[model samples]
Target: MNNLATPGMLTAVWISLIVYMGVILYFVVRGARLTTNMADYATGTFQFSPAAIGLSLAAGMTSAATFIINPGFIAYYGISAFLSMAVFLPIGAIISLIVFSKRFRKIGSAVNAKTIAQWVGIRYNSASFRLYMAFLSILHLTFIVLIAVGLTQVLSRALNVDALPALSGIVIFTFGYMMFGGANSLVYTNMIQALLKVVVAVVLLFSGYQLFTNADAGFFQQLQQIDPKLTAAFNTDSPLYRDFFEVVICQLIVGVAIVCQPHIITRSLLLKDDKGMNRFLWVAVILLILFFTVVFTGLYARVLFPDLMVAGKPLPLDAVMSAYVTTYFSPVVSLFLVVGLLASGVATLESLIQSISTTITTDIIAAFAPNVIGKQQLFVNRLVIAVMAAVTIAMSYQQLVNPDLSVGILAQNGVYASFSAAFVPLLFGMFLKNVPVQAAFSASVAAVVAHFGIYYGRLTPYMETGTRNPGIAAALAILISLLVGAVVLVLYRQTKKEVAV
Candidate 1:
């Protein structure tokens, strides 16, 4: 299909785009005026209410990755992925609230940390750690930019616009505005965008159910029409079925990456205290459950359009929802999906960009140019955002060129997200009872090495199958980090004892 949109559909898309963009812009403006100082620019002056922080965290976690790829997850894995997400996400949020925020808030406040890398620098007294952390900071910035580019593609496809100019305009306009207002704009605007995401997700949910009109037939009937294996809970004979459980289990572990996620962690720094995080933990957990559960919409797509899924074959689950959206939903609804899509992509990208800028400005830039201030600092930040935008845009183009990179591949690229390796040790050192700095350093290095080794070694089942998931590898890597951290801690303690004697 050249473009799935009709002339009538295009008009509806335009109307939704104008209204949503305007609403987003208002929040951006409001956030800018409210930002009075550098503090306000980063961490909302440590004054984010539970509501704002909760929304930012939820929105950051649930990106277009959730909207686009998650449904595909459901289409691919049936009910199992959903089950794991339900069980796993709450564990992540509780850890974030009960374990992380209080400790992080104290450290962030004491050191006046602007970014995770800056936080690491303060916590560890290591310039090398800061350098590695900055690289990871830019790493996420690259991914978010790729997300932005993907959002551009989805938006262009749905709205019936040529993608090239659309992406160029989006990159320039959004990046500049984001650099101008800094994190001040990001938090409030993200809160607003995040709120809109709720509306959009709700719309997708009901509309999806609406599209799945045959409640009487439901899973079995749909399976009968398509391959019985489409909803097959498990069958030893089928490779896909046997592998699905392992894949979802891996997803659950990668869900732990939520712990190290800097964008979400940045929200922790914004909160007033642990109370702010604990107060809204359940709400955030619910939001994620809703987000993951909504992935079932892809199942609805698979069922409702049996022809789309071939007789013997399980359709390319990744493309099924986009196809369904074009055919099944109203033009207006698809537009809202696009809006949610845009919000999700931009939200993730914006948060990453902010984190990167914060690191560069607070750690690297400030280290080199301590006297930098006002418009100049802002200019430096803008330069960082522009570079990030350009690089990610390139990554996006590469993904498009490499048609082999599916939703799962792109989403799983998150295994490489810096939080797991760079921030994890520092945060663990602060929160864990007896973690030594030396241990933190070793864990930090070991996790990175282990992640790359397990992944590239072709040792994991995911590698044997040709599909890749960094989630399980990430979990192993983190565990390795902890184990190494512990050993290093013990050794350091013993050496100190001998020195004292």
Candidate 2:
């Protein structure tokens, strides 16, 4: 029983293609006729409405990881992992909304800012700030691209096709849509994609609930039934469960790093006023509830289907999410799931491309050739965009070629890429005003070390043991980062007084 294919399912694939591609095309067309001003390219002129901004914010923050592997969290970690983000994420968004959002809007409106680099230059009066921000900009692009590639591959599987062609087509679609529409387009596209994904994921989650209640296959019972020998928590029997601290350490550390994410921060920059940021509180509540639903759906699917148990033990990253879509639902519905994946991937990549273009033109190029103008900069920017995309595509495909690679393994790289670059600087910028430019520079070095420590030190052990809670390890890393930062502040003060006298 190939089980993935049915007449109804085949119709689903085509229908979803039409619907998903149409929405994405609409997304791409939003900024097609704009002038070549850097302001126009980077921030969409801040003309997007609040609803559009909120919706896009919702969509842009999610990626293939949310759709594909988020469920893996529930399958492995139980429910509390969901609760931490449930509480933390909305609070994070609210803080952004009430505190950071207004400041960002006022600053952007006041200065006609284009990118965070431009803001840094204005705030710090330093070319070095822009240079540092630019490199950080490239780092955002890498993870964004990584997530997009994963989404496209998963979407292809939903269509019952090889992933190579899907990657090519999706990238072309992403490139064309984003290259044309720029930020303005992304605003609207994220809105559409977000709503679409939320609605679809929620519906499926509820259906999964019904499957658990009305049907006889709820997750725990199904698990008990699926394999009796599988009994026991990480400590009791499973090897991965033996080191629960590692899981807690990894996830919590990842959460702490989440504070610095540029993709998330960019949303703060797009707000119309401080009020919108406050409004973000309600938005955060809504999104987390939806996110929890999606996670549980994956967990439920794990229980419902035992055949996905790869090698009689291992489960694929898309194990529950993809299998549930293709195995149980009609093909048309599965196609919509594919569409969701594609939309998520494109929205993510579009933002990445925009960030990369801005960083290349503003940070890297203008430095060496301050006088460089117009058509040439466009050429250079496009060149950078292509080169960066090519690298991301290569990195993602290398993993895909080796299907033996688990989503969990690839996801760890995301944890490293995300936290190390974005977290420390953003935190320092907010909390530590007295730290000198050199100290800020040095903190990134410290963060890089911390990133490796968490990755090599604790996360590896947790992963090997299949431990669910990585919280303890995360707290340690953040604490270390804070202590190191304080030491930097004190040392800088001593040096400053010596120079002044």
Candidate 3:
């Protein structure tokens, strides 16, 4: 809330942002020139290297949450939060990404699928089901809002501007360029952003080097001196990392299903062919592991701001990282860090805008009004981005003003529910043949119902808190979806056998 940016820092940030915007526009123009139709916009005609696409994947998958937001959880809860967020979650997610990418790419490329919704609908051989999945994709707006808010938090502090104007500028600029660029520009820009992020990640990770070396009691001991809970494996004081179930099991489930999102999974389609798959996976996994470790910087922030205050004002969870960067670093170093933070959020925002707008245009609108599927589709997609921009601005403003601990909570709720529904369908569709559309549809519906039901209805002890863990809700929903799908499949098979007999 406090203005922490020096005049020099503010001037540097504005200049950097302007230069960054110009670079982005160059790519957008280049990519737009190649983007003739919806297919080209979705997958791109230009053949990109595996390493570039890998960087893009790592960038999109990490997002503002990993860089800007999740660290606040670590700042609040400590090693427990880090283990769940940085360690266990990534373990599940990396393995899932590795396992799912090849199969998903093979199927998606075969079907010429542009979005996850289309993949689901095509895999299930149901138009109505595809429409349903497309509509469900709107849940990703929550994530867009999360990134927008996170970016606003960083930019507002860096530019020494108010939140509203910062939020507006971010939404308009990112969405505007995204309307033109699609996958072509997205991959290239994300590659650059990922590289910047790698530098920033290293800087942030080592920022607390003095604390670790200078402390007589050592780092963990210093944390223990501050609060014994900070050094604990499971911080019972924290809602999210209170138990083994919450810390490990639920995160594992959510991590595996996290790839079900459109932006994350459809990334594989950017690859020209199967030969690049190994390089892509290796690059993505290694970079992502590094990005994930940036959350440890939150622990550093905690060490610095033990009371979590800047100039006597309490630091909001969302503002913690921004505050730390501006307060601790020199003006020039802070400028670089600020740009990296912006890149982290903007990278994902672009991917989300491209994927979600494509889904709405290609899968949802095209299904409802087949006439909108042709040359007019690109125009329609831009309109969709405009509408999304407006919605994101509105929602981001609300979250910026009034957050439930952090915007990450709201994002996780919507994002988790969406992927929870998609998980069973995508997994079954990919691995299990002869899967009935009815089974998939029923499972998706059940997952949605169970997720929201448990979350809002407060059916579990975890949900009883004001700030509930979306992971727990999503984990439950996934299990319920699997059970319901398996049951329906069994019944359908038995019915077929009886009829044959």
* Best candidate (score: TM-score): 3
Q: Using TM-score as the measure, what is the rank order of every candidate, best first?
A: 3, 1, 2
Q: Write down the lDDT that model 3 would get.
A: 0.91
Q: What would the TM-score be for candidate 3 when compared with the true structure?
A: 0.98
Higher-TM-score candidate among 1 and 3?
Answer: 3
Candidate 3 — which residues are off by over 4 angstroms?
A: 1-4
Q: Compared with the true structure, what per-residue lDDT tens digits does model 2 show for residues 1-501?
A: 122455666676767778777866765664656636555666765466666776666666666666665665445444433433334444444444345445545665676656666655555567886677666566565465456556755666665667677666666666655555667677877777777788677766776655457465565666667554333333234322344443344444555456354555566666656666656545644664574346656556656555556335555554446656656666556666667766655665676677667667867788989887665665567666767667666666666666333444454444445445445555565555654655555665566565556655655444344433333333455556666766877888998899999
Writing each residue's lDDT as its tens digit, candidate 3 over 159-222 gives 8889999999999989988988988788999999999999999999999888878747788888
Give me the overall lDDT of model 1: 0.65
By summed lDDT, which 10 consecutive residues of candidate 1 come out lowest?
233-242
TM-score of each: 0.88, 0.83, 0.98
Error of 1 at 157 (Å): 2.2
Q: For candidate 2, what is the TM-score?
A: 0.83
Ranking under lDDT, best-scoring first? 3, 1, 2
Compare the candidates by lDDT and give the number of the best one: 3
How close to the true structure is residue 195 of candidate 1, measured as C-alpha lDDT?
76
